[model samples]
Target: MALNYDEIVGKFDKYIFNTYTRQPVAIKKACGAVVTDVNGKEYIDCVAGIAVNNVGHCHPAVVEAIKRQAEQLIHVSNLYYTEQQALLAEQLVNLTEMDRVFFCNSGAEAVEGALKLARKATGKKEFIAAEHAFHGRTRGALSVTHKEKYRKPFEPLAPAVFVPYDDADAIREAITEDTAGVILEAIQGEAGVIIPSDGYMKEVREICDETGTLLIVDEVQTGFGRTGKWFAREHSGIKPDIMTLAKAMGGGFPMGAMLAREDVAANFGRGDHASTFGGNALSCAAALANIEVIKKEKLVARSNEFGAYLMKKLKNLNKDYVKEIRGKGLMVGMELSIKCEDIVGKARERGVLLNCTSDSTLRFVPPLSITKEQLDRTVEVLDGI
Candidate 1:
């Protein structure tokens, strides 16, 4: 039987929480860089599951890996080990040059783990995060996340100080003896893809070193070739004490990880932190295959190449309302003088799915596998709008 969009929506309205402001279209299926709605209308997915499907949606390799693993060992408690877990951990370490990893289930969970690890490792209570930074929504993650609306109701979160992003001086001033770590996103996703200055991260790293504070890079959205490099940290040439990963890590499968230097990771001894489903056989298999697909397709280099192409096309639009176009690699944002919510609707009508961030910036985080022709179509839709 065919899915009825109205029925699905009615069920959601009756049973689901009224939390998200979701797009009107109901996606039924996706392949590569396109998603088909229940009505069979296809949209070139510029959103790419909000930058999760980096290897493109439903990659055959990832699907096969998940299916094979599920048949044998879908899961087992963390008390025991699995080959899938071991292999995925080694691969994550190799890719990021991090010493150890703790797996979880989502970006927020990864942030929770990273924050916990930082506090435990440093034996401090306060964290320094940037203004406009969107770390996560959990209490611990929210304590560091900087948004009045999201934080107002959930007051009295864990101790944290908000500083101006990309401002090393402000960070230096904000740090105190109680500061356990400084958390930042290499490219601010929810704050409209705000990319820091070239030396910003390097400067922050030096400051953390001088102050003996842990530097935690939240790469939840920027990791896995989203920013051209395997990780956005590569662009800065700095190694953080702790890092968080998710979104694209499992090629759409739910998975997250908190990685750290060996010295910092050691602080999280047995019984310190654990996720029941973290690093389970199924998720690990999916992640291992996801990494393999990223390597085999050379998607990292492709992202760099195609991101330039998309940026050039967007630049040629020549609209006075355009405020700024900035990003690294595939994680690009077009900030507008006016709110872009309506523009997202317009693009959707024209068969190109778009997402507006921070209310005014149209974020373009397409799959690394998106074709140049599809990119042209997406830009053309914007031109028409």
Candidate 2:
């Protein structure tokens, strides 16, 4: 006899780490933008696995590559090189202006590696980050994350100062000779799709240039075509010294990369930094397929077009609860006059999935491959809500 879904969830509750407050639904399978729970309930997945499934769930290209690679090779230590890793690295370098790449297993690891490189390269300790920013959950990443609720228990985070986002004057005041880098998210995903003002990124670039401090952009959520462009920074017309990537890079498999200039990456030497499973052949193959699909399908352009349509439809809803709607490309947020969790629950019940950010903002980061017709259905659900 097979185990029932409730029994499986009960086992998970007893055995798994007690860190995350997971939703009650037991998702069993997913295709395109729809997810089915163990109980056979279907849902429209507007959250897109927290922006990880930019190309949609179980995309054929990514799945095929993974199947082929699994037969050829699965795991390899850093001692030996493989063609998949090389190809993926080349694709990442060509996709971005950064010189070299370092592969890791998760967004937090990428953030950790970037922080180490920045501090070692500049020989400084202190750093500056934005208020309401979330880099990752690692100790080093958390140190730069500014939420007191998240940081209070974990005292003595890495020495860093928090400054108001999109405020150039505040950023200038926060920086000093001791500051090694200025780390930020091009768009604050966890803080509710908070986009900085126009030219805000350019101003930060100029400031970093003047201060001789490395500029690190945490694109873990915004990278890999989530923001229409290949990268959110491309929209700003500014270049970062080091860019951290993860989330959608592996198309579901766990992977992350830090893109840095050649000179800065040389600080790691041979053994200074390493991940046992970084750039493993299987993940690299999946990532290569993922990037190819993004390019071949022009899903980035579709995200831009469909996202604009979605935003327009949402704006027309114009309910008194809506305080503001802000975003770029497919990364969008809606601020409400009241708490958004109730609305999120309502949307979920109506088969339109979404999540709230920091209490008041509703976040939408759907798959780039999502169709306009599907978005129309989502809007219909929203209208009823």
Winner by lDDT: 1
After superposing candidate 2 on the true structure, give the runs of residues whose Cα lies further than 4 Å from its correct spot. Answer: none
Each candidate: what lDDT? 0.95, 0.90
Q: Candidate 1, TM-score vs. the true structure?
A: 0.99
Q: How well is each residue in 125-164 modelled by candidate 2, as lDDT tens digits? A: 9989999999998999999999998899998889999999
Compared with the true structure, model 2 gives a TM-score of: 0.98
Candidate 2: C-alpha lDDT: 0.90
Total backbone collisions for each predicted model: 0, 0
Q: Candidate 1, residue 101: CA error in Å?
A: 0.6
How many clashing residue pairs, candidate 1?
0
Pairs with steric clashes in candidate 2: none
